[model samples]
Target: MKKRVGLILLLFSVFLVPANPNPVVAQDGKDREYYETRGDIVWEVPTDKKVIALTFDDGPDPTYTPQIAELLKQYHARATFFVVGSRVNSFPEVARLLANEQHELANHTYTHPDMRRISPGKLAQEVAKTQETIYEVTGAKPQLFRPPGGYYSESIVNIAKRAGALVIMWSWHQDTRDWSDPGVKKIVNKVLKNARNGDIVLFHDYGGNRKQTVQALKEILPELQSRGYQFVTVSELMNHYGTKKVGQGN
Candidate 1:
């Protein structure tokens, strides 16, 4: 009789346990591992088509931002700008202009902290503020987040994922390193020499004298176009490569 009563209690506890058991939270671990094993983050889309994404960081600069927009328009290319929150507040019109021109305006966090060193709460604030600012200014919610300096942690990735963003890093080979004010020829060569299908080339529209970046684009855009390559926003590149599952924006 005592054994029968204990078995009943055990069955009762099992029935009381919640089914589904927070599936989203349960999957977060798997998702986090998926991102980490892919070279710190989604550096490049996996594809064989002659397509690539040109991403700019640290801006919406009053001067260079507009100049970069014009250059993109001229070349009939589309790129993504990972913008800082404070700068977005300072230059909503620039953000709007990029959105208006069909260029993607994504989050680069507020104040641009090295995300690996910050707490998850601080990281969330950085990303949330940027997302709020961008949405307020452009009426488009950003689906992509690029941590400042390309530094990330598992916590960073989970925070971004929970906030509805996919962390975007860039191909090591395709990085222009334009923030160093590299000369136009060097910047141009870095991209043209190592260019490939599904490559995400990093450039900067702000954070210093970006005259070289502007000039490099003038050469890079046309040369890539001539080579039968098409420039795309990060989202479009992901779409072509099927990096994210359908209906799964992350």
Candidate 2:
């Protein structure tokens, strides 16, 4: 009878083991390892419709945000802004403006910390705090999260996933290096050479003077228009072209 009881207890413990304990899940039918590592960085757009997402990171600066917003309005284009939480407090109106204009306000962390180096608790706090700040300022919880410097690990994805954010990375980088004030011509050349359909382009709204980057976007938008490209926000692009996973956008 003791041996029988031991067998039952062992079976019970097996039932207690958690299912899907792995921190990452690749929902699009791709191998989880492929999607988890380099794949999450989004090196390319992976489609052919001239649909591209223009995403700006590290933003809501008083000096640059308004200017970029006005330029986007000029082209009747939509973009996503991955904003820092502390900056939201510094320039709340920019958050309101992005919402009013229908651009996405995504989480980029509270102080732009290197997310990979931080503890999971701090990472959760960063994501949670920013989500709250975004909703407080914009009245909507952002569904996406972009790490500072495009850094992510399995643990980062796990923390963000637990916080109910989809990890968003970019494809088709324009690489303006706008932080260094690279000339508009260089920025334009990067996009002109690389711009493609279903691509997500990365730019910055804050971190330094972004005048050349702004000028480059003005040029790139019209030029791409002539080439027959349509601008969409990141979520729209994913929905329209990217492989949809169940439970996504739920």
Candidate 3:
């Protein structure tokens, strides 16, 4: 009776769980080359000039987003915005303005689900939906895709590539952690102290209570400018530095 009940519960759980899209490939003796060259991951580039990509994630918020954009404008810098598709629908005008201001509008996701492990079908849907939304609302489809919370697998990268996006990650040392509302000085230091010529510094525009991010930016923009850093969108920076492939090393 005990064994029978265990079997019954196992079967019930099987019915509820979905299969992983990229099942474990046997590493013993097959398809080793494809395994070696699978996913696209761009964290930073290698350029000699003082140019970097400043990227904002989880945005299109009515409040903080516009303020950040204004700050960027004051510095005459252009940055990329990784926006949630649903928020774009909620505030299409804000998105339109980002595009009009010449900021790159990239895909964060439709609902910002953790993309670390997801089925191929669901991942494809999330990528396609956000691509469509950005194109539909702003008249330009996004080419850069960053996984929610930086949680992405090799399969997730390939899936995003299939949807016509280059997976974007930030520089190893430039993550501000401003989403946690770390003190304004800390956010300022994270970027200013770690600024580099091919660094991709991460910030957020739409997460809760980003006044610290906003405040940090006011200081960051001016200080970085004074230090001779030219800010450009992810795509533009990539173009400037020949980022035709992802994951260029310093």
Q: Largest lDDT belongs to which candidate?
A: 1
* Top of the candidates by TM-score: 1
TM-score of 3: 0.82
TM-score of each: 0.83, 0.81, 0.82
The local distance difference test score of each candidate is 0.83, 0.77, 0.82
lDDT per residue for candidate 3 within 66-159, as digits (tens), equals 9999999999999999999999989999999999999999988899885545666887898899999999999997888888877555566677
How well does candidate 2 match the true structure in TM-score terms? 0.81
Each candidate: RMSD: 14.9, 13.6, 8.0
Error of 2 at 58 (Å): 0.6
Model 2 Cα lDDT, one tens digit per residue, 38-118: 434343446767787888989899988888999889888889999999999788998999889999888899999864367
Ranked candidates, highest TM-score first? 1, 3, 2
> Of the candidates numbered 2 and 3, which has the greater TM-score value?
3
Output the better candidate (1/3) by lDDT. 1
The reply for model 2, stretches above 4 Å from the true place, is 1-33, 36-45, 245-250
